[model samples]
Target: MDEVAAAIADPVRRHILTMLRDESLSAGDIATRFAISRPAVSRHLRVLRESGLVRDELVGRKRIYRLDPGPLAPLAEWLAGLAGGDRWERRLDALETEIYRTRRERRARGPVEHRREHTA
Candidate 1:
């Protein structure tokens, strides 16, 4: 997970992953899309490949890269918990505590009788 996080920390690598998400592209194809040098793109690809975020195959003389999202599951799940589940749980627990405190305060205050004043 740490490897995947580190690999995606660079905007270049993230863009590469986004590109590969749709279709596989050869190393040359990817490099051409970026303003950076081919060697720089190759290094980013190597980091992604090592992290298992992408898989590559040598077809003929060209190396093709594709997104492999399986390894991202753990990271995605962790992010999901942070964004949704755990946050909601904390909010609901806070709400419940507030509700209990309000109820206790109301009980302590006792019921009040309504009184009307007539215009003189």
Candidate 2:
């Protein structure tokens, strides 16, 4: 998971992944999409391949790159867990309701009456 996160941390690599999401592309095809040199894009692809976010196959003379998506499962599960429940929100709402009720009760009681002592 750490390797996957590190691989996806780059905006350029993320964009590369987006490009490969629907279709596979050759290394040259991916390089053409960016302003960077082919070597730079190749380095990014290497990192992605090592991290398991992408897979490449040799087709004829060209190597085609495609999104694997399997390594991202752990990241997706973790994110889903974070967004899974409203229990925290419900607890906060209950606390807020209790605070408001206490304030309302105090206000309804008005001011406190004081006993005055009479001295001879």
Clashing pairs in 1: none
lDDT of 1 by residue, 1-120 (tens): 899888889999999999999999999999999999999999999999999999999999999999999989999998897779888899999999999998887777665511221222
lDDT of 2 by residue, 1-120 (tens): 999999999999999999999899999999999999999999999999999999999999999999999999999888768896576778999999999998787677664511121231
The reply for model 1, stretches above 4 Å from the true place, is 86-120
TM-score of 2: 0.69
True-vs-predicted CA distance for residue 114, candidate 2, Å: 45
* TM-score of each predicted structure versus truth: 0.71, 0.69
The 0-to-1 C-alpha lDDT of every candidate, in the order given, reads 0.91, 0.92
